[model samples]
Target: MEKLVIGLVQTHDDAEAAAERVIDCGYTRQEVSLLMTEATRDRCFPSPDVAPPSSTFGAAVAMSVVVPDLGFVVAGPLAAVVASAVGAGITGGLREILITAGVPRHWAERYQAGVRQGGILVSVFARSERDVGLLHLVLDDPHMTSFHTEAHRHHAYDTSF
Candidate 1:
């Protein structure tokens, strides 16, 4: 159980220009997916499940943003009861809740009780571009990006059933 490299910046463009090319390459958290559009995911995370799967338009709020050290845009939780209500001190001890493994806890208690003014992070797993370091500033078609480890397994930490 030792692997970490998630830099999947698959884009059609516009999530702030894929978060400004994932913050100019230094990298700092990313797993967004608006796959469909939905007004560019509701102008970047003003969500109500934007809705886009068929074709018309939907599926915005593509998330996963935690520009730590680089500073700003700090929010995470791609599900799991909103990362266990954002309880634990986030990132430390890997307390992203939803039973652990990153982001949740009511979207980090609504971004630490500020009511979320920032967002990005909608990856249900499968992120390995070498644990994410801007990965050459967004895939750039290295065979449509490549890197995987078990791909999907689910059930992390458990949080009691």
Candidate 2:
């Protein structure tokens, strides 16, 4: 069954490492997404003076987006969900994005608050139990608080971004 495996990390350093490991676990860059505040991105990420932007998050699927209501910086396939939320006329896109991705509304609210409070979200979509398990293992890595899933449902319609 297809699933969206997700977890939260307290620090940006942990977020970066966990995301790299997600890629190392054999999931395509296209399958991963990250959401954090712009402040978190600025504080944790290296400046352009140090190295090319793509090197930090990998070149294949790295992008920086600015979403209002919380100044979110979204990267990877989940950006599609944000766009869908916007296209649907919702404000404060993150919570809606999480819900539209099949997360329950209550959990989505908490996740939205979590991100606002400086937690980084790491998420991946997988169609196989193997891939989902691999993601769970990564999310259970050091510094991960816990993980959640929305299995076999694509509430966002087109999760292929």
Candidate 3:
């Protein structure tokens, strides 16, 4: 995998809707993890087996997609989501958030540059009538080959999630 794109969707009323938006953006139903505020502390996963707590925010779902080539075609939806989620597109706060979420600073910079150079965005994160918090996005470093190899190894043996 060249990049691991992670997106976080927080909604106050309809967690399901936010989840559906992620699904609509091309991620499968299984790829998205729905976490309620009560089931987690600060949206972090404590353990693999622990269930999330109930939150007044309703739910915070995390979804991811791995891009092997790091091409524009594969990153279209993600770019769109980032563009829409952050009002100023890929600059200012959104750029900072991506870096904070584990996307290497260099990769984030390149992504922004690509967008600025005229890349087409197909779809963005779905907006809801209810309060929707920051839609965080991260693009992991492409130079890390060992993690991809391990993931491939596990993927070959285990198809269940």
Candidate 4:
């Protein structure tokens, strides 16, 4: 299983600087990818001076650094470096992102239990890798109806047994 340490840095409406920061933080070329999804461009990072402070003031850039073997240990400093570069605070932690990704509440709880039992909680985000890995699971699917339908079907099978 692959482990990813994700971080979001609110850029000063500058995607270039954000990308550079990700690289400067010791991320390999292959491990770090820029966040450029439509939903992210439209919602999380709208036009400059148009969005409220509650929303992103300018471009909101996110980067995912793929930790080869140990994600949990490296996540903290990785997040801090990204956040410091853009002067933005870190958002919720990994468990929060997992819950936001539509993982069932019970599943999250179970994972926590497993962690307590010395089991590593490796998570997989089912959406597009870039969207989930970079956007911090905030980008909602545009095709929600169909997505929910499929999710419901999958949930039914899981619960049936």
TM-score per prediction, in order, is: 0.27, 0.76, 0.25, 0.25
User: Tens digit of lDDT per residue, candidate 3, span 5-96?
Assistant: 33222222233343455555455544433312222222332332343454311222222222212222222334333334344433454345
Q: lDDT winner among the candidates?
A: 2
- Model 1 per-residue lDDT tens digits across residues 1-161: 21221222233333335444544554443333222223323454444354444321122233433333222232333433333434334443222332244434543343232212223222323234343433333422232222212221221222222
Instruction: State each model's CA lDDT, in order.
Output: 0.32, 0.67, 0.32, 0.33
**Ten-residue region with minimum lDDT total, candidate 1:** 148-157
Off by over 4 Å in 3: 1-3, 6-26, 29-93, 120-161
Runs off by more than 4 Å, candidate 2 = 51-55, 58-62, 142-161
Q: Regarding lDDT, does 3 or 4 come out ahead?
A: 4
Number of backbone collisions per candidate, in order?
28, 0, 4, 0
Mind sharing the TM-score for model 1? Answer: 0.27
Q: Write one digit per residue (lDDT tens) for candidate 4, span 69-156.
A: 2223212222333334234332443343334434466544443343333332212222333433333332212233321222222221
* Candidate 3: Cα lDDT at 4: 31
**lDDT of candidate 4?**
0.33
lDDT tens per residue, model 2, 1-161: 45677777776557667777888987766666788888877666665466355554633223466786647888887777787788887775678777777777876887788787778887887667666666667765454434334431222222333
Clashing residue pairs for model 3 = 38-53, 38-54, 39-52, 39-53
TM-score of 2: 0.76
